[model samples]
Target chain A: MNATEPKPTEEILESLADAKSVFIVGCSGCPVGCDVGGEKWVDEMTAAVRGAGKDVTGSALIELLCNKALVGIKLGRIVEQVTAAEAVLVGSCGVGVQAVGNMVARRTVPALNTICLGDYQGLWPGEERCGECGECVLAYTGGLCPITLCAKSLVNGQCGGTGDNGECEVSPDHPCGWKKIYDRLKELGRIDDMRRMIDPRDARKRAIPDAIRRTTRYALEVSEQEDPAPASEE
Target chain B: MSKLQQQLEAGKFVVTGEIGPPKGTNIEPVLHEAEEYLKDNVAAVNVTDIQTAVMRLGSMALCHMLIDRGIEPVFQMVCRDRNRLALQSDLLSAAALGIENVLALTGDHVVMGDHVQATPVFDLDSVGLLAAISNLEAGTDMGLDIKGNPNKLDGVPKFFKGCCTTPCSPTPEAQMIKLEKKVASGAQFVQTQAVYDPGAFENFMKMIEHIKVPVLVGIVLLKSAGMGKYMNRSVPGVQVPDQIIQRLTDAPKEDRAKVSVEIAAEIIRQVRPICQGAHLMTLGWDHCVPGIIKQANLT
Candidate 1:
């Protein structure tokens, strides 16, 4: 997610402009810990909507957006409320926005800007961590993901712009990812790793296509539970 | 002027402020802010303990830090974090260190903070904590066994205990009951939650005219219409009127800060005559406080 991309602000304003009732849905996953898409964001958003002259019916927080089973059970109750209202505002990650979009016929709007997927660093009071490149190079970088660190996202060698004091030229406080890598290797008694010139990274692995997929454990669980017999037994 | 001395000899209104400790060991900035308020001639500075359920450097340590800087700190001791023993120890330490002022509060729930699963320790509510402080002042712990003999702590430093009240509660009767309990539990002063509408504060003052303790009106600087509404919804005691929200909305983005200072100054102007003093909750808008004071003609 791009940090600057504004989320569904216009959608929220239009949907709730004349609405008599609204229900805010918050995600309990990524945004919860980051203090953005979770219940706190919902609370702040709900208050902002009410402040803007709208009647909020009530709000609820869901555990995970990708959990279709939980969403199926929970969305029905929320949809019942939304049916009476003009719109439903979602304060969740991009996944939550899509889930609610799919579940709630065509009415609900999203309030939050789905920024990124990093922990709350407090630089911006309520912004997400965005690791742009779709590559996980933590193993080679000594657990510090360089994709988010290096200003240029250089995977091979240290940039000439690295300051003598070991801070990045772009942001002095932020350490150069390559410098960090060099220091970590030196501490591990493996300085030779930096002396050898490494080849360029495979660009295809880092190329993020337009659409992402949820082919992980959450999607697998949903597909395996197509038959609801076991749920009935439980 | 010393806070107690100002309270004793009052002509001009007294000004008090709150400092929310940062959520880490990095307290230099927090201390710098406290020193700034102290330099501004504020009667007292309140150091909050785990405010809004967020953990920070404990109030006891921060209070000592303020005292070390020659600022009189009103140490805030919430019942949500510590039990009776820890509470008593902290109180004794406060008294020993000459940090006399104390504000007793029933802290926010643990779920509201960063660590949700952290167990809450609400062994005693605010009133009980006040009663415990009174007991400690009387030289007896909660167990009623005197350390050396009966009434031994008479020579220890005394605490100026305070409590909080929500002036804009939907139900005044319920609020009055809580206020009465606080007064009965040995609270000498009452600091209220944010008061946006002066009319509500006037009505509340009329309702509690019989209360003998000094009432300090809380004045929070409005950052935005969104912030005001958020506090009204999420924070338990605060209620910002629709007109204030509209004023903030109508204000241009560049002039919103000016409008906020103006609104806070107006609130203080309207309520100063009815209360003992005004406690400004800058909400991290520390730089605006001196401006608010000047605009309100409080200096």
Candidate 2:
């Protein structure tokens, strides 16, 4: 499932300050589990938006907000109310919010901040996944993603600040990600995988940047092809 | 080679000191303390970069100033503030300025610092940073030559590369594994997180027997009993035993500094036989380094 958290109340209110009417779009997928972008969450957000004295034109909880076709058909059901609203407040992952923004002509504000995972989630509910780093050392790491688990996103190994209880130094309550990798590798009799030094993650090799910018890929590709040298008389 | 590296190579029980650059331009007092108290006693003084993630005068400038004052500085570069390009450029700058020792760290998360709202740039973890240093030393940057070849550097810079470890981590194997990676990535030396337990340190040293780099045990001077208790409660992988805290608590208010020095010196004595050196992190008490050195008979 996708992980999402609500934007701060002040930030959400400030972004919607100029709009008198707001239409809410909630994702029934991952956000439901997070309790921030589901049907219940949309209802709470509607009241909260109404509490701020803005007129909420309508609210719709789409089964998968990230699915652009579903969002298009769903918005079609409430076309007049969606058009009447000055802005659409999306309670979904960044992908879903972008989907809503693409379909609507009005201002689309995000109510939630999408949590990036190392591994892109599929239909299964497991927490771990590939971080999209160019190099896949999962076989060596016992299938644990250090990039996703470690607060520092250290791929080589654990940092020196691991807590006394095998928790992360940044968040003591969470178990150290590298420790989990070590335990899993040990159980599999592949502890030697932890021995080799994982080279510095080449950001050039990382897939996240390209994945995020795919929507604007054509514009980026055109800009890369065009040189900005001015024709001048010497 | 840096004096610290030379001493470590010569099998000398080298002692290093740490100093944090101030938040503003009024850096003379801290520099003066280092020059006066730390310059001669320690092999090299580490200038912390935005230490504890608090924004401050950059470590490179302070390190250069230390050089101006005839004191060698271990330029501590944390991967918390700069991206890879900036980090690589700074490494070249440190080398150009004649700063020899470089300690790479992942750095404390920004949440621990004064600028909690600041975005942390972990573009490179410590292992990656250490590798970057190694790459720069090999006359290539972390980037390519556009034709998929390693980019050549204008001039190669040599540094006594160092990495840090937490000796008493709950997951010792994880720490050890990272230490091995750091060494493999060209960490010529290691300085650990503040370790109070001599017994635990001995065990850690034994565990890392395969890593040939000289290790300097970290000893952050406990300023007071309250500080020790605070560390025990809040600081990770750092446990200050009760007897030491009790000693600090019982020491008459005037003798607290002396007790702290004595305690530090005692720990140094305990760990000296197993480790190569002691890294005295006096925090703000620079004057205590000389006293600890004298008490530990490392003068």
Candidate 3:
């Protein structure tokens, strides 16, 4: 799932200072595992916003805050509470905040900086899994991503700035992306494959892709497909 | 016919040279180098188009200059700078200007160049471009224009188009698949990335044994052990064997250039029979060109 973390309460307060009343929103799936968005976290946030001298008009632990339909149905019931609040505090990823904003047509303030698609180690952010750049070149360059991991996103070849010990020159703590790719290709008995270059991605090929977008290749059915509605009476 | 094309047709061991366009309007640097290549009996000189993403004089201009001087020029076209229309226009102009032997390439990404801020307009990849070039030759368009001017153009360039290949890829099958696509798209020949390991290149060549197109192995001169290591660590597709790195390291700086020439000559001798030709890339060390050709005795 798209991983996220709770913004520092102080940071969220900066955007909420002008609002006398606020509504809290949180995600049920990823943010729950991430510890930033859950029933307990929503209560905590309500208390904090209340402590900041703002009234907690209403709040909900959204099943998936990024889901427009679920958000519409849930927020539709809380129309009076939503209108009473000056703004919303979304305790999920940026996508969730944007999704909430898109659904309610109200100001949605993100309480978390959406990080990479993550493997949540704990409630706090730890690791990034996928970059979601539309193209997945993981098979060619080991299981890691040079696009996000490497400072220079060098695809065709590695920059000549590598230190001999196989550490990234830009970040000493991080393992060099190209070195990792080289070693992985070597281990896979396919070192010669590094010679070929990945073509530049067509930025227009994939639009702001939703759950079940179809492309020339396989359809990426990220969400469950629903059966077609019975044809309308002629 | 272009000298490179003629030599390839004759089944001769071809030797092509490289000359980057001068960054400024200085025409002398390019002309002087072209004259040197001609004197060295270089079959053709491949003019780079903003190689390494660095801005330079257009390859087409230098090519025209060489053509006027009665020299064969292989025009290098990269997809990084131009969209399909501009690319197709240049292709037609290259043929109309008597420039044959075009090399289609997906140039270095813009971030690697001085003009990092410039937007990259890679409307097509190398394989896509080869297909476009073939379509252009077939009296059709790249299908980029939607208005359906599907009628044939008044003039079309019959280019002896070639494309670049990475012979020593980590995934040989993937490389083969793309190479097959390039050939299918009407690429007449292919010049590979600089090869250092004979065994690796041999395996790649073996996989590509069925293809009838000529494969000219790229040979970039290695000046020192440090450079070799740098390329090994950073340069994609190009790797220097540890032994060669050790060989250069064992030599003093004064003799490193000599050792480099000798090593290149040896590689040329070894791969001369296996491949169609040797594409000698004199990466700013043009003086060593004569010594390499003479030592290798490549025609």
Off by over 4 Å in 1: A1-234, B8-11, B146-155
Better of 1 and 3 by DockQ: 3
Model 1 DockQ (Cα-based): 0.01
Candidate 1 clash pair list: A117-A129, A118-A129
Chain A TM value for model 2 = 0.52
Q: For each candidate, report its DockQ versus the true two-chain complex.
A: 0.01, 0.46, 0.04
Q: What is chain B's TM-score across the candidates, in the order shown? A: 0.93, 0.99, 0.95
Q: Using lDDT, rank the candidates from best to worst.
A: 2, 3, 1
Q: What ranking of all candidate models by TM-score puts the best one first?
A: 2, 3, 1
lDDT of 2 by residue, B57-168 (tens): 9899999999999999999999989999999999999999999999999999888889988887898889889989999999999887779999998889999999999898
What is the model-wide C-alpha lDDT for candidate 2? 0.82
Model 1 steric clash total: 2
lDDT per residue for candidate 1 within B1-299, as digits (tens), equals: 34754673565577888888888889998788777755466778888888867767788788888888887888998766777779888888788777889998867656667777787665666667777788787767766344555444655557888888877755453356556766877888888888898998999999999888788888988999999888765564467899999999999999999999999999988888898888888877777878888998988
Summarize candidate 3's per-residue lDDT along A1-234 as a digit string, tens digits.
Answer: 554556677767875666788988878867776577788888899889999888999998878765667777898998888878877777765445545655663456667654533222222222333343444444345434556555455454353334446655444566656676666556545555455556645444223343223432113222223365789999
Residue A214, candidate 3: alpha-carbon lDDT? 41
> Residue B246's C-alpha lDDT in candidate 1?
94
lDDT of 1 by residue, A1-234 (tens): 221122455545654565667777777665564456655677778887888878887777887654545665787876666666555676654445545644554344545544332322222212122243323333233333345555544444343334445655445576666676666544544443333322223333334333332435334544564565564554
